[model samples]
Target chain A: MSLAELIEQRRFVGREFLVWLWFESELFEGRFSLDALGACELWLEGQITLVQEKEQSRLKGAAPSSAPEAHEALRQGKLPSQARVRVTRGELEYAFLFNADAFALAGVKIPSVVKDAADEQFYERMYLIEELETLFTALYGEFLALRLSAAWETGVAPFVRAWVRGEPVDVAAYQKLRGKLAPVRGAARSRTTPPPAQAPERAARVVA
Target chain B: MGALKGSISFSKFYVRGELPDGFRDRFAERIQLRAFRPLTVEEDAEQRAGWCSIENPLDCELDHGKIFFNSYLNLGLRTDRWQVPSALFKAHFAEAEREHLAKRGREKLGRREKEELRAVVSRKLRAQLMPVMKVVDLSWNLEAGVVRFWNQSPRAHEGLAELFEDTFELDLVPESPYTAARELGLTSEQLAAFEVLKPTVFHAESTLGGAR
Candidate 1:
């Protein structure tokens, strides 16, 4: 097939990836450990755009990574084309608007600034940008791990399928993993504080 | 913000296919800088286009043990008749018709005469109009097949991809989530599953759905 045709054929995959990300964040609160990618934290932050071409409607929601409305739209066959997300690893945090169709990043905010080191600032900035790219690469690597795993067809696919259809998902084993990943709800949990509740239908509350 | 100061926006592509022998030499031939040339706008045509690299080797630098290469592709276009006012054309055509009628003793200029006049006017107008130039930056990792273009325009992306293929005979695939996953080394079974992969929905109640 021609290159354009090939790219068009893979468009759905990009949309699915966004959906997977939404599922991962809402279900596990953005905590996952993969043998290949190790422990990584991701959260959908700021604005998100979900497009449903057949319906000719674009649904948008902002902040609180767990937006139920966004999930609702996804359940209704809408897929995210763009999202503002925050990714954290160790002491570094990178926030950017990610475009699913183009796999592009814009308005990226790198981790804490390197203070007053004029001559070193240039190199430091480059280092941080490269680091962010590496993190993105690794995240994709993790997705590939789960996506290609045998469990995907045997179980995970069906699990995600059911969730996408607005059906209840209570597979106990995944729940145990989530529970283990969930932060303890007191003083020790401030770091993983649930995003503040939003408007009634739009609220992205992470149900414990 | 861009990968560096003063730069903004970029689109990502995953490089596929092996670089042929003497890749650098071949790449240099394709990306060598050229003097700016004006686009040749055909009469009555809406626009004409041509493109070339803005700089040779673009830029190469090393930072923290990694090498980065950047290049830019510039596309230029010229309009033939867009800026010429219809009134001016009408006036010119009227004068041309009058001259034709007087010379040939005919009441009106023939279709050929009118066409000829239009061509003249179009050419004149095109000479007065300036060409528009668009620049898209390319960032490549010397070791990895990662290419980040500083523009998301579909036309620009396709153009750059075509240029790269022509230059290095390598294909550029968009690292869409699925393609990326497949490239990460898939087994036969996984490949089969991927072929039939379907979009999954996320339900609020399904937070614990994958535990089994």
Candidate 2:
């Protein structure tokens, strides 16, 4: 098959990856610890757009990632197409609208570029872009590792199935899978901040 | 095009195939713009698409490992006869017909003949007009097998891909999660698992913006 044909055939992988990230963000309560990258938090913020192309319908939610409506749309068989997401590592935060179809991050708002020297301005911007790309690559690497693992079918898939079906998910089973996840390759290990605390109501969403 | 300044929005692609013989010199020759020669109006279709180096406007050269150029394209269309002011065209046509009859002793003109005349007039008017301009930046790191394009819109991407293929004779595969997975060089079983992996909902608690 041609390269274009191959890409077209595999476009759903990106869509599924986005949806899976949403699932992980919610399941792990936004804080995921890659083997060596320390703990990082990812949140769906600003705007979320869920699309069901077959149904010719789209659900848009400006609410936070934890919003029930967004989950409800997922239950109705919609996949996230575009979402504004914030990724926090250490004391830094980067926000961008990710489009799954194109695998493009738009309107990226990196942490402020503070430079005293005028000549260093270009290098600073490039560094920021590379930093953000590295963070995203680390997350993707973690997802890939978990996805291809032997435990995925035996452990992780069942919990996700139960959750998507609106059934009572087995948290113990989910935690077991999480425990087995290895650190992504080349993940940074120097982050020092503690994982952010989760609200009580946020935990309730899983049960609700 | 100069220094990679400011926040850049681009699409990344994995370049395929080795550079052809005399690539830099041939590339420089390919992008040089020819002197202006007006296009024939008789031809219904003409493509004003080519590449020109952004840095050296006067000459085309890839001085360093990196080459930045603008893919330029232009398209032109004439106003339809039906879109012309009906009353005004009718009056003008009548006067022209009278003048033609007096000059050449012709009666009524045939449909094809009238169309030919209309096309000639449309071409004349269109000559004074300009084609729509489209310019997009491309930075190719020949050794790194990476290319970054400024425009990510679907149409522009298609055009860029086609232009790149035409120029370099190489395939540019967009690096997506799927393609990135392929690049990892996984085993067959792992590849199968990658294909079937479904979404998991992580139920981690909220407080994304709150103090830890």
Q: Pick the DockQ winner.
A: 1
lDDT, candidate 2, A39-68, per-residue tens = 789878888777777552344456455677
Point to the candidate with the largest TM-score. 2
User: Per-residue CA lDDT of candidate 1, range A1-208, in tens?
Assistant: 5545545665666666666677777667787554433566888877888887855234445563356676677667677888887888777888888888766777778775543432233334445666676566555555554554555544465667666765655646555433333221110111111111210122131232
Model 1, range B1-212, lDDT digits (tens) per residue?
23334434667777788767876555554444222233565645553322333232212221211221222122221111245677876887677668877888888766887788778767776677654445454556444566666667787677677666665577888766555555555567666666666554443334344334
| Regions of model 2 farther than 4 Å from truth | A1-5, A56-64, A112-126, A165-173, A183-208, B1-9, B19-47, B53-115, B195-212
Q: What is the C-alpha lDDT of each candidate?
A: 0.56, 0.58
Angstrom error of the Cα, residue B163, model 2: value is: 1.7
Docking class of 2: incorrect
- How many residue pairs clash in model 2? 17
Which sections of candidate 1 miss by over 4 Å?
A1-7, A34-39, A56-61, A64-68, A106-130, A157-172, A175-208, B1-8, B20-22, B33-36, B40-111, B201-212
**CA shift at A138, candidate 2, in angstroms?**
2.0
